[model samples]
Target: MNFDKRAQLIRKYDVPGPRYTSYPTVPYWKNEPLSNEEWLQSIHRNQKHFSSDDVSLYVHLPYCESLCTFCGCHKRITKNHSVEQPYIDAVIKEWQLYKSAGLEKSRIKELHFGGGTPTFFQADELVRLVHSLLENQQVDPSEVEMGFEAHPNNTSKEHLEKLHTLGFRRLSLGVQDYNPRVQKAINRIQPFSQVKKVHELARGIGYNSISHDLVFGLPKQSLKDMLFTVEKTLELRPDRISLYSYAHVPWVKRTGQRGFDENDLPTGEVKRELYEQAKLRLLDVGYLEIGMDHFALKEDSLAQAFLSKNLHRNFMGYTTQNTPMLIGLGMSAISDSWFGFAQNKKSVEAYIDGINKDQLPVFRGHLLTKEDLVIRQHILDLMCHFETELGVHDSFDFNLNVLLRLKGMVEDRLIEIDGNTLRITEEGIPFVRNVCMIFDQSLQSSASREGVFSRTI
Candidate 1:
């Protein structure tokens, strides 16, 4: 398709939509009928299906030295190092509370550090935090897949070496755009040289996988600018790449994205062309699309997971491992127990106060209904495999009304429906969020959709 036509299509379909990171999608989560006791029971019940070696842990480090204009993630902006110790101590206390809830310590199989910039903490502090968790748990480091996000400008040799010693094999660095103007607009001033140095340092420390995050459709971004970023990214030769569309939702992110004007950003057509251009360039350089917005080399774990049909998606995006129980620590983190989802308090002081009072620090959550579970499974399949088998419905009480709603999408050539299976066609990749929307009963019934989601395109 030509850029004009593609842009028109995006304009037509780029309505408000959820990212499908979670089935209930946070906004639709039922805040009532949930308590910390119910949350713990859900985890305990789900843990019975797998041994301790199958659990995954997600730790949220919410501090960042500065704000990035296009970011919508939960974060605390401050350059002071004084906040690190108290936050780390609170995280340890939170983990101890989980341990006290009867969760077995030996069951951890994965540990991922997500952040406002996990590297915002000093290297030794990070080591101390990880060691504290290990000290209280009976975890086997050999079986654990440990990783963290690193800011290329601040990630040092000591950081890499110390994290490597702690068994972190993977690292993801944010390189939103190599263009200096775009970097300046986002308030993240990182040079290509700094990124290269971090990449080389990570490799020198024997890190197995390195991923770079790039963005398209940012304010003041052009085709030439995107190509420049892609060319520079190719030079780094990272194992994985996440090419994300810059979601301009100033209503929610408020101060973060307010730096740039809407007129300065590309329109739908230009944005689509930018994505298509980057996609072609990446494929030419041997990166396979693992799922929406993510690409990996053929030999990388992500690609291997895709080939094996073992790919999974969670709040952390895509992963190779599927764990029914995930414990999210720190402020504003959400933990998914398959049966239910729980989110912690968003304020650091509130989190600390709750933990000090010996509480779970969870402020809200939802328990999945029977329909929710079925829809969630299908969404997971579509997101991971680009197709899903509806045959699994024979054992569940799913309403066929949802399938009837997808007929229009099938006619639009966005998807193919065949003998109880629905597959997203190549033309439908960009509209994956729309296809998932067909099954979102809550969203369909809601009166206010505009305030709840960002654009799907």
Candidate 2:
């Protein structure tokens, strides 16, 4: 992956594509209503394959006092602190509904609190929420992998200490960047000292596996800004670093990304360089690259999983644990039963309304077809391990037509086809999404792909 070759590939492959966080993505899902019976059947099917005790839980906290213009997550903007307790109560009720609907699995193997900002709620509010979630029983911190997303500016020492006491060992701080210009453009104005304080506090509180989120291709971001940010990140030496590509989809996010001028964003090669150089800096400092844009130390669980080719990517992005059922509990949250995908109401009011009716709150869903199941395995393997084998699927035909579609990638040295196996080259790491897209029959046939996704490179 030399500089010249990298630049050429970036220019050639810079096209709109889904992030492949989920197979059949969301747009390709059927638009019909998700019935209660259908969702239950999916859950029953999942239970047959997975252990009843092993479950992954994702709780989405969609409240943020201030808006970070670059964000694409579904969230409610408000300065009102009163929205906190009510929202927690609604989420707890939703969890109860899942239990009544046949979600008997109680032992959570992986639990993550993600949001507009998980720290937006008061410390006591989080306690009540988690207590109800775990059935008012104290959990052994070692029994579960608990993590949360925090805004460094708002993540107080009390927040860290309280969460640590409740079995939360992982902390992901939204550093985004240390560059003031980049911070101002994104409207997440936190100083380096503020982030430093939070990082030190989390470590002092005995939290493990700290991850810092840094974005490339941001508005007004330059090579110097990236270097400085990387330098500051190294100062803290967090366990994991997520070098995310800034998805500037103003058309989709509407007003969220409209605050900053689009012209200021780095595109194509410039955007790739920001990541490439920063990746080099991270690798030089002993950080090993994980799946996609994530990097971690060798001792980190994510890094260990990657080394063993067991890393997985779902709607939670990349994760160490790949449960048979991932139940997302919150507004706009998505649940996956391995063979089916269901989403809750997008609007906060609608979500709360549906929950009050003693329902699952799922509005739409898709049951995976035979072809979808085969393609999903291929995409998941490619995304997590950078390779896949044709022999895995007995019913699906991995024939000449599919090979013809991937000929361009093979010729460009982005991938190497060894008999019935296909592997992404080191240079092809950036084009993993493109390779996966070719196998996506729905995306390939969909005319809506132009605006529905961001650039792959």
Candidate 3:
């Protein structure tokens, strides 16, 4: 698609919407006192029907030394290193809680460390954490995948080497942008040299799937800025690239997005162009676009997953693995049992308190209904593959009004509808979120849209 055509589509389709990381997204979750005991039961119940008891694991280390004003993740900004051991211990205890609940024998096929800065903990501390989780467990390196998010500024050579030794091969760096003006605007001031050095160190340690994260539509971002950032990124030749739209949702409390003047940020077609032009450069360099906002080399597992139509997504975003159950062990971490969703307490202190009391730290959860499960499948199909086929026997009777709503999109060439099958056009990839929102019964039925989600461009 040309820049002009994409720009025109942006005007027609850019609107605030959920990214659909989960269907019946968080806001629609029936958090009206989820049963802690019932949640555990759901895990056992789901395991019975699921093909494998092996699960994916996500550990959220929510401590950061400084604030990145553009970040919206749940985190606490403090430079104190003393807080590390206690947090690590608490997470280990949480893992034990699940093991005691009868998951002691399940193999962890995937493990990911995500956070304010995963490298904030000492290398030895992280080693101890991984060791404890994998103790008495034998995992084949090829079958088990491990990854972590790293802040290039603070990630050390030891951090790279130690994690590689622990079976983690994927290293994702948050290189939001290399432009000084944009960096200053977002309050993340790592230099290009810093990122390059970290990249080289991780590469030297034999980390195979290195990914660089880039964001468009920042306060001072421009088409030139994006091109330059992509050019600098190409010098490193990362295996995967994530070009995310900088979601401007200052209404979200404590996100620190308010640090920048909203007026200075790009909007509408301008922001869309930043992605379109940068995408062209990546395509020219032989990178294949993954599900959304991500690209990978043809050889990377992620690209292969997309090509093979086996890609999966969860709270941690896209993944090469589609484990039936995801066990999250950390403060504010979320767990998916394929039948229910449970979240640990958001506060570090409270989470540790719950674990100390020999209790699950979950403060909120949602048990999916049969209809929700069917809707979830359709949404997943669209998000991962851009199309879905519905039959009359499908459990959830999709609303007639919902299908009628797609008339506009079909007329715009953003979608093609024939009977019960829906497919987004090649030109409509950027509007996937917008297209998904139409199928969102909660968002469509609700009376309000304010303060819920960011623009979908």
State each candidate's clash count.
2, 0, 0
Model with the higher TM-score, candidate 1 or 2: 2
Q: Between candidates 1 and 3, which one is better according to TM-score? A: 3
Q: What is candidate 2's lDDT per residue for 39-116, written digit by digit as tens?
A: 878888888776565778899999898889999999999989998988899999998988877765557788899987
How far residue 220's Cα lies from its native spot in candidate 2, in Å, is: 0.3
TM-score of 2: 0.97
Shift of residue 209 alpha carbon in model 3, Å = 0.2
- Best-to-worst TM-score order: 2, 3, 1
On residues 75-156, what C-alpha lDDT tens digit does candidate 3 reach at each position? Answer: 8899999999999998898889898998888898999999978999999999999999998888666788999999998999
Residue 436 miss distance in model 3 (angstroms): 1.1
Off by over 4 Å in 2: 136-138, 394-398
